[model samples]
Target: MEPSKSSDDKQVAPPRRVSFKYRSGPAALRCLSDGLVYFAKPSEFNDCLEAKFDHSSVADYIERMDRSIRSVSEQRSCAGGYAVPEGDLASFEAKTACDDVNFLEATQRVGIYSTASRPDNQPMWTYYSDNSKGFCFELEWPDTVLGRYQIAPVGVLYSSAARVHNRADIFDTLIREEAELHPDWSMDQILEETRSEFFRFRFQMLNTCRAVSIKHSDWSHEHEVRFVTPRAGPLPIMGQILKRVYFVRTDFPEWGPVMMLLHQLYPTVELAKMSFQHVEPYVRVQGMTKKLVPVHE
Candidate 1:
C-alpha cells in the first residue's frame, strides 16, 4: 500500500509550498454552498441550446453570492493593490446595463479606454518585492487618477473558477446587450465571434487596469494589474508589446497553480512568472563593481 519511486529510485521533491499567507483555521470556505464552479453546476453550460443560461436566475444567485462575498470581502489578498476591471467600470456609451452591449463592443470599449488613459511615463521597477508581503506594480499614476486603493486577494478555492465566472458574467451580459445592438446577427454568429480567445485576451488585457502606469507594458495599476513589456524586460515568449502581457497580481496565490493556470488560459501569449514565495534581494557591493554605477533597494 505504498507509493512508487522515480526512475533512479530517488525521491521526487514535492511541489514548493505556495507563498500565500495563511488565514483563519479550517472551516470549509463556502462557495456556491459546496464548491460549485461559477455559481452553477458544470453541467449547466451547453453550447448547443437555444438559450443556454437562465439570466434571471443567475442574477439572483449572483446577488446572494455577492452578499456573502461582501461579508468576507475585507480579508486581504495577493491583489497587486489597484482598481481592477470589475471595480473601475463607468457607464458604457450604451448606458443600459445589460442586453445593450455585445462582445465586440465590450472588447472595443476597453481598448479605447485603455489607450486613451495611458500615461507617458511610468516608474521603473524590478520584480515582486514588498516588505509587507504584498506584490504590486510600482507606477507613476497621474495626479488626476492616483489615489490610495487597497486590494483583497482572492481565495485559493475560487481563484481560477472565479475568473471564469467573473469574465463570463461580463461576457454574457454583453452578449445579451449584443442581442440589442446586433439585432440582425444570429445566435450562431454571436457565439462564434465571442468564443475566440483572441477577443477574450484583447478584452481581458484592456480590462484589469483602470490607469496605465507601466512604462512599456500594456496593462497598468497601482494595485490592480500591470505588466512589463518585452522592451521593459518581460520574458521573450510574450509577443509584441500591448498584445501579450507578462505578469499581474490578483487575490490569489502567487506561486500556486496560478502559473500553470495562466499558461493554459492564454495559450499563445506568455505570462511573466510571479512566485508566491518571497524572493531575497541579490547582494552587490561597491567592491564587487568595477564600473561606475549605483544599485540600491
Candidate 2:
C-alpha cells in the first residue's frame, strides 16, 4: 500500500544493499524445505524493548488525539460539512484517547518483523547462528524478488538514548480529506470510518517507522536491517532472493544432511564456509575468511 501523502513522508533514495540471516541448521532446513521465511512477532524477540518506543507514551497519544479531532473539526467547518462544536471536543478527545492507545498497541502486537545483519558480524553468528554450529543465508535484493514478496528492507536506526516523538500532526491531512469527502457525517462517524487509515499512517510516519525499525545504539554492532509486515506468518519466497549460504562449520555433524538437502533444493545457490582470522596489531578487529565451495551431489 502506498503511504498516505503528508509532510511526514520522507523521500529516500533506494540503495543497493545485501544482508545476511544467521539460522540454526534445523531452521535453515525448514526455511529451504518449505520455501517460506517465518516473520516473527516482536514478543518473540530476545530484547524486551523490541518494539517499545517513546511514541507509545501517553503524552504522544494525547497530542495525536487532540490534533486528529481538531483537524476533522476544522475541515468540516471550512467545507460546509457537519462540524463538531468546540465544547464537545473535550469529550471526543477523551473517547478517542482510548481508541488511539488501543489501536497502537494492537498494531504493535500484530506486526511481524524479520531481521538480517551485515555478513561480517561475528557476534551475530555467535548469538543467532547457534554459535557457529549453524549457517547464514546471504540475501540480495533483486527487483523481482523484492517486488514479488513486498520485502522492502529498512536499515535500523540505532540511538544512544531514548527519543520522544510528540508528533501530533500525524493524521491531520488524511483526516481532513476524509472529512471533506464525507461532509454529512459527524466527527465521530468520520473518525470511525478512518480509524484504520489513521493508525496505518501513524505507524508509517517518519518519526516512528512502524515502531519496529529503531533499536538501541548498543546493538549497532549487528548492523541490522529489517523487513516488516502487518500480518505474522510464513511468507513464501518466490524468486532468486537467496544468493549464498555460509556454513559456520562444515565439520559440524548435522551439516552432512543439511548440505545435501540444500544442494538438492537450491542447486544454483553458492555455498561457502566461514572462518575468522585475527591479524596482529588490530586486536579488536577480526577478519572473516570465507571459502566458496560448491555443494556436490
Candidate 3:
C-alpha cells in the first residue's frame, strides 16, 4: 500500500516531483504486473493492455508502446548524459533529443499537470466529463463497483500556471472551435461547461502541472508519453472516448490527502452531463485527466 504522506512527511521529502511528461515501459505504469491489478482477468488484460499485441490496426497502441520504450532508452544513452540540449528551454516534460521545430508547431501545451497522485498504478485515465477525459484512474477497496484501480505511465496536460498562461489561451481556441461546431447548444450551456471545465482545469493544473498534445508521427510516441504504457486493450482506443457519461468514485480514502477535499463529495457520479452539484465536486476534487492532448491540438 502507498502509505499516505502526512503533511509533515511531504515537507520532509516528496517523491521526486513526478515528471508530468509520460514515460512508457518500466517507468510509467512502472511494470506490466502492476497494471494488471486493475484488470479482473488476463483476457481482459490482453484486450486492454497486451503490449505484445497480436492484431493490426492503423494505430497499433501496444506496438507503438513497445518501440517507444526501446527508442527512448537509446536516446538517453546517446544524449551524452544530458536530459535536454543545454540551451533550448523547451517543454522538458516530453521531448525527443532532436528538438525539432515541427514538434512544437504540431503540439500545444494547455495545462501543466504533475504526476497523478502516487500509488502503484499511475493515471491510466481519470478526470473526464461528457467532454470526458480518462486514461488513468483508481478506486478504493470495499467499494461495490471499482475497487482501487489505476494504470501507469502519465501524459501531459497544459498548465494553467502563470508562465504558460498565454500558451493555454492559444490551446483553448480549439475548444472554441469545438463549441462553434455545436450549433444546437445554447450559450449558457457552453459557458457552464466552460466554467466548470476551467474550474477543474485550473485545479488539475495545480495538481499535475502540464497537459501537452502533439501530432502523431512514427517517431514522436517513442519518447514523450506515459499515458498508455504498452496501451490497454479492454480499454477503448482513446479516440472513441470523448463527450460521454462516466462514473467517478468519491469515497476513496486513497485520494484522501492528494485531494484536500476528498470528503466533500457524495459517491459515484455521471460525469458527462455537466448539470449536477454532485458531479461538479469531482472537477474540484478529482478532475478527469484528458487521455492525451489529442494529436490535432
RMSD of each: 22.8, 10.6, 23.1
Order of candidates by lDDT, top first?
2, 3, 1
User: Judged by lDDT against the true structure, how good is candidate 1?
Assistant: 0.27
Most TM-score-accurate candidate: 2
Runs in model 2 lying further than 4 Å from the true structure: 1-15, 54-92, 95-99, 143-152, 163-208, 280-297
Q: What's the distance in Å from true for residue 94, model 1?
A: 15
Q: Give the per-residue lDDT of model 3 (tens digit) for 177-286.
A: 43556656554454455457665454333222222322224323223333321222333211111111122333433222322221122123112211124453433322
- Which RMSD does model 2 reach against the true structure? 10.6
lDDT of 2 at 81: 29
Best by lDDT: 2
The local lDDT score (0 to 100) that residue 286 gets in candidate 3 is 26
What would the per-residue lDDT of candidate 1 be over residues 1-297, giving only the tens digit for each residue? 111132333778654211111111111011111321111111232212211222233344345434433322223221111122454344332232453234223222221111112111122112222221222211222222211211111111111111222333344444555455676765555556666776565335333221122121222231222221211111221111112222223334443333333244334432232333334533211111012246798
**Residue 161 error for model 3, in Å?**
17
Alpha carbon RMSD to native, model 3: 23.1
- Predicted candidate 2 versus true structure: per-residue lDDT over 256-285, tens digit per residue: 766666667776776665567675432222
Model 1 stretches with alpha carbons more than 4 Å out: 1-62, 65-104, 112-138, 145-158, 162-224, 227-297
lDDT of 1 at 27: 11
For residue 5, what is the lDDT in candidate 2?
Answer: 33
Q: What is the C-alpha lDDT of each candidate?
A: 0.27, 0.64, 0.28
Model 3 lDDT at residue 137:
28
